[model samples]
Target: MYIEPSYIFLVVPAILLTMYAQSKVNTTFNKYLRVASISGYTGAEAARAILHSAGIYDVQVEMIPGQLTDHYDPRSKTLRLSSTVYNSHSIAAIGVAAHEVGHAIQHNKGYMFLTIRNTIVPVVNIGSQMAMPLIVLGLIFSSFLVNLGILLFSGIVLFQLITLPVEFNASRRAISILENEGFLAANEIGPAKKVLSAAALTYVASAAVAIANLLHLITVFGGRRDD
Candidate 1:
């Protein structure tokens, strides 16, 4: 297989940014994880309180194992918090909990971006799985396959792009809820913001990587149609 120099040029920087984003989130989370919030609300309590404040009593808050694995399941209407965030009263924990709750709030409010993201998730999953194999086979066989594969892979890139505003909005909502609800002290809010901001960087890096990969594919295989 011939490697394109453009692949390295286009993709390597995004990969490096991804590595940096992961490191930053981990480091920032850990740093804030040790700083207990003055509110003294465990992550679970903080999440529940915020949900109740928003009149979202139907959503269940539950604990799950792992670090940085917290998420909101809109279908189940459940917010699953990781062990790190579920039990800890640290500023990082509360911020993360609030962020996941923000997603629940979005679901409740019918946020347009979140709705679009959820609707396309199934299509994106199929596209992501089939894209690479189609692209590779196209290289060996038909131009039609190449074009089809690129189209499928383009969905993945589109999904990533759509995800950015969703994540950013959640983080912003988390900050606002945390401040308004007094989940964190005036001094502690800054540290919580740092944690959420670091996490948001990871999402930005992911979108960058997806865009870079899409560009690489277009540059390398886009013109392979049979003449």
Candidate 2:
């Protein structure tokens, strides 16, 4: 099966858009975080406060070295924050920290999407790593292998689609906590929303690219079967 150049064209824009959205969100979040006052609370403190308020005392908030690498690890029940957010007394820092804490909340609440995502995590990891190689090799060899590749790549697309709501819900919970808990003021909500919204777009672009690539692969390989 011949790979279509059109698929490459389709994915190029999505790749660029995802990169641009990521950079924009990082820049915007950092800029606002640097300037927004947090009423004397640091990011770590804010995260702890949020977790405590949510009755999640077992989750540990740890400082990790890196920029914008913060995430919640459910396995270890650790909320890892980058150095800047871990210690900063800024709105962006609080917002980001709370966002990660939101995941812990989801875990505690038994959120269905989170559960589903966790269940598929291993499959997505393996499928994503293997799909492209399988597809390319199959295309170079035989139609049967090509069909298998497409099926594997379809799994990747499904995983990306499943990821969308999980991320968006986390952001929504973060924003709500910031507002209800008074971590962010009215003036600060706009910037926080921008940061989170921009961040969400990266996921959207990723899903779109995955779907487009899968479609392209199917078009090429499926056509061969028909012929």
Candidate 3:
């Protein structure tokens, strides 16, 4: 039950940033959600238009129930829009929808970072799920397990690091598409960009938290070994 100073110095700030990021995204999205786009295209229509414009006709746009649960399924070539986004003609909806289409475009073109991120997804998944448990058990049992767990946890950090560019690229693409494609008016573009930017902050925050946790683990456990 030994507490590491690094936990307070590293993990706490990361956690706070994550909370702020989450709150910012929600507030920004909701604020723009009420402002309907001048183009009158729903989120699903915007996604489809962006895909088609990218010459990616194979990706299907589907509506799913949830708030901010939108995602692109690269394997199935499907872009799923959340309930809040699917039928909404708001600037926030179009920006979020276009962002998902950016992923589709990345998939279609085999964007290098996205490809690399997808490639190790299975391993990262397993590593993330088992890392904490392994670490906890190792504290009572074996240093070897502790080391192995830290190695596994490192994959999570790596994944998040790779994800930074992917998410930022998508947001940039979203903003460009919204502006160039006339999805949002000149004045509305700023708001749309704000929505996407806020969403991107969440990814940054997540990466920070992952790195902090990894550092906390290494520092705490490494100190234990030295003793």
Q: Which candidate is the best by lDDT?
A: 1
In candidate 3, stretches whose alpha carbon ends up further than 4 angstroms from where it belongs are 223-227
lDDT of 2: 0.84
State each model's CA lDDT, in order.
Answer: 0.94, 0.84, 0.91
Model 1 lDDT tens row, 78-174 = 9999999999989999999999999999999999999999999999999999999998998888988998999999999999999999999999999
Scored against the true structure, residue 133 in model 2 reaches a CA lDDT of: 81
Model 3: per-residue lDDT, tens digit, 80-176?
9999999999999999999999998888888999999999999999998999888888889888778889999999999999999999998888888
- Candidate 1 TM-score, true structure as reference: 0.97
Model 3: C-alpha RMSD to truth? 1.7
| lDDT per residue (tens digit) for residues 3-22 in model 2 | 56867777777778788888
Clashing pairs in 1: none
TM-score of each: 0.97, 0.91, 0.96
TM-score: which is higher, 1 or 2? 1
> Which is better, 1 or 3, measured by lDDT?
1
